[model samples]
Target: MVFYALGSKFIQEKKDRENTPPKAQEVIYYSLAIGHHLGVIDCLKPQITCKVAEYDAWIAQLPIDGEARRKLEGVKRFGEINIDGTHTHLLAVALHHSLPQMTEQQQQWSRELIALLQRMENEPAIYLLVRRHDDW
Candidate 1:
């Protein structure tokens, strides 16, 4: 189980380093897988980050392809994306950079992962819209 988690991170990092457009999408997916394995979906929450708008703006800058963008669309909850077909890595990166304050139940390993990523300067812009991409 632990190795699975580590493997996910390794794959994510490898993709991130590639920094190509398609590779960015791959990084987003693999990172989310790692995030899910690490239980980040359960740890971060709607109320944690006051800067959802900022985070959303940052995410918007990434050249997310149509499929990945569509995957990220139509979500009402942060955790929902984990099961709703949105890329997990993108979700994890969003939570990490958003600096959301977690609930008591969520203050655990996930938080540590977010903090660690943040420490590594993995900052990106985020986009928050009232509706979906249509609202943008």
Candidate 2:
């Protein structure tokens, strides 16, 4: 899961560098989505870094090809896993990042969401399920 997140971040950076859009649109989309999931994980486990730089270095060695991109697209489309409340989790992270200036109500909501995420992250089964990615 950590590797997927780091790889996705690397891919997003690669895509951002190109002036033209990536030929594999689905790959880019799924990369960003997975990266977002990583962000949520980071929020839950603030102390965990997962050697992201090492993962990025390893990901740089991989070749991006049509077949791989198609597989990623298929995983994104056909994978049965459903992640609920991701939007709310994202919103909480966003609000937390925007702290100090955020309204009291927003801050309270962010704290509540973070608490809920912490609980979810503590569940061994949920953690195992979320960490599994068929595309990898």
Question: Which candidate tops TM-score?
Answer: 2
lDDT of prediction 1? 0.38
- Superpose all Cα atoms of candidate 2 onto the true structure and report the RMSD in Å to 1 decimal: 17.4
Q: Put down candidate 1 lDDT per residue, 1-136, tens digits, no spaces.
A: 0101122233335555576576666666555545645655442223223234543443353345544344444343432343222234654555454434544323443465344334334322111111222232
Misplaced by over 4 Å in model 1 are 1-50, 76-79, 83-136
State the C-alpha lDDT per candidate: 0.38, 0.36
Worst 10 residues of 2 by lDDT: 123-132
Work out how many backbone clashes candidate 2 has.
0
lDDT of 2 by residue, 18-88 (tens): 75355555565454445444654442222112233332332232234433223213323543223333333
What's model 1's lDDT at 116?
Answer: 38
